[model samples]
Target: MNLNFITSQISSICSSVWNCIISLDPKVISTIVSIIALAITALTLYANTKNNKKNNFDNLFFHLISLLNKIIISSENNSEKVEITLNDIKKQNKAQLETLKSQKIKEYYEQHKLAVNSRFVELENMYLKIESKKLEKIKKSNNTTDTAVPIRKSEFLSPIDDLDEINTSDRSQVYYSYYQNNTTDEALNYPFDVSDNGIETLLRMTSFKSNPSLAIYNIFNSDGGISQFKANINVLKSEYPQNETIDKINIELSELFLHKNMNIPSEISEDMKKDIVNDILLDNKHGSYFRTVHRILKIILDFSKSEAVLNKYCGILRTQLSERHLIILFYNAQYTDRGKKFKNLVAKMNLWGDNSELDVGANSDAIHFATNNLIWKDKDLKILKEEYVRK
Candidate 1:
């Protein structure tokens, strides 16, 4: 067939159909046109809505996966960070699902829930492995048998000789730069102007209140003072039976004597230092020992006029006590009014440090201890000690 003939035939059929429709009532034609337009518009709107919903679901799904992956990647030995990331996922999951309004999206949410739960399991496993390694490191460090010469009971309990005649106003400054100057091997001989009774009195006074006259304070604040304090405490620990009250008193006295900015001895291998830091961060029972001590120290600091004195005490407490001893001491004070005050102080102190600071002195470990300490309490500490320390 010729092209022209086909075109003319098609045009004639369309003209005939148009004439028939035109010949009908004008009102009927208008109504029919309106119905056709409405149907076309509705179909277009439905297709667009479907496409938009699909895109939204895809975005949500990808976002969920990305967030979870980030959380997994960022989770190292840090339980605190992992917990925070997990909480973010929880919040985002709800918000993401709320914006979606489709059966498909709801199904995706169900699947996402399973995936997230699985990721959390992975995170928990990671935390446990980190914790196990840290505990092992501490166990090795504390495994040494108590082999020092036994302290005589009379030595600790003896009355201060010449207490009435001793010049209290002219207390000599005993320098104890043990760790600061790397003097770990030097005998920690304090100037014996005060007798054993005097030392005991000072220790007792430290347990109850701050006493600047305590010659031990000078020892604790000095460089390498931590080692000296540790040596002294170990002596006491050996002499006395494992009385919780005695342990508590020793810890309190140690806190009063140590410096706040004291560093771990350089002789300690980098690996050991790393282990200590990890333990401090992850091991709830033993690691948290300093936290409870810090809480008590905060109360003391609140009323203390000398920052130098308080920091030294904190330093000694942080450095000298074993993880086991710290846990016991923390429990002893956990129920006291001062313990509650310490908890509140830790929360407030956590927000004070800057991550970019290079000087370890400038970024005090006290703040970190305070921040992490708030995470667990007496019950948690007890469980951790029973599970990790006792074993």
Candidate 2:
């Protein structure tokens, strides 16, 4: 009985009513009313169908668009979240790598520091053993009573007085003489006639023996204890008459010092003189500040040379050479009466290792070598100020 059946029945009734009305009392008005009612019902049915179809299409279209938009938005959000997650992972990895790098550097420094300390200890033990053996040999010779002066201490002392006459540049002449004169197993076994050279050679020799007794022999003769082999230096000069090797060493050192410091008449600079007065005359009461300054100057001169051997032993840490640290290194090389006190402080504070602190407040007279001041004065001044304040 849906809309179609009802509309058909109404139309049929309207037609019948029209005919009835037409037949009765010449009713033109009734026939017109019935015709109008049938027309209105047909129009109503057609309009309802059209509106229902339009509503259905509108709802379907709106729902389809909403679904597509939701999918697109979800995809974009997932992409952004994924990107963020990946970035976080990358950042974490980078942080870990940096941390590991720092740790490796620290560990390497620690190992090297330990090795140096151990080597120093070994040298001390060897020195003690050699002294004891030498004493026993003298006792066995029964020459103890004949000895003019009783031995006050071991021949090898902490530091020997600076021999004004001896120069490293002249060593080749000494070495060549020892090589020529001494063909004995003992002499040939030693590369140089000096005890210090011997000790240094022994430390360095792994498979080959260059000079076994160089360091010990130097120490023995230079210590003012032994009279034997005192003429070794002269003998070496005689054998190598030309002394070409010694000249070469002196010339090389001279050139290096001059070129490195950018100063004039480089040969004059090569004659580095360190005043050891403060060290030798050190008193217990008041301190000598001027001596420290002089020692610092000497260190500066030594380090100014292009081929300074100390830098080579410093290894990678050498690259971190700043003016302040160089001053500290100079301090380390200086001969001072206050060395024991300072060294004690350094030992207690772990100053030889990672926790070491440099006297940053030191005067930066050495900085001119590292940087130019004319163009970058402001920047250089700021850095200098910061270093100067960090004692």
Q: State which candidate has the highest TM-score.
A: 1
| Model 1: how far residue 34 lies from native, Å | 1.5
| Best-matching candidate per lDDT | 1
Candidate 1: residue 245 lDDT (0-100): 46
Question: What's the TM-score of every candidate structure?
Answer: 0.19, 0.16
In model 2, the runs with Cα more than 4 Å from the true position are: 1-111, 144-391
lDDT, candidate 2, 1-391, per-residue tens: 5999999999999999878777776466767778899999999989998788657644653454344334323543233432343244335444545455445433433444444334323333444354455445545665524223122133333332222212233233332221121121222222333443322333333211232223222223233312222233333344456656434433332333232332222111111111222322232111222233223223332333332322332222223333333223223223344454443222221112221222123454222223231112333234334432223
lDDT of each: 0.39, 0.35
Instruction: List, residue by residue over 156-213, the lDDT tens digit for candidate 1.
Output: 2222322222223312222211111212222442333333322333334333124323
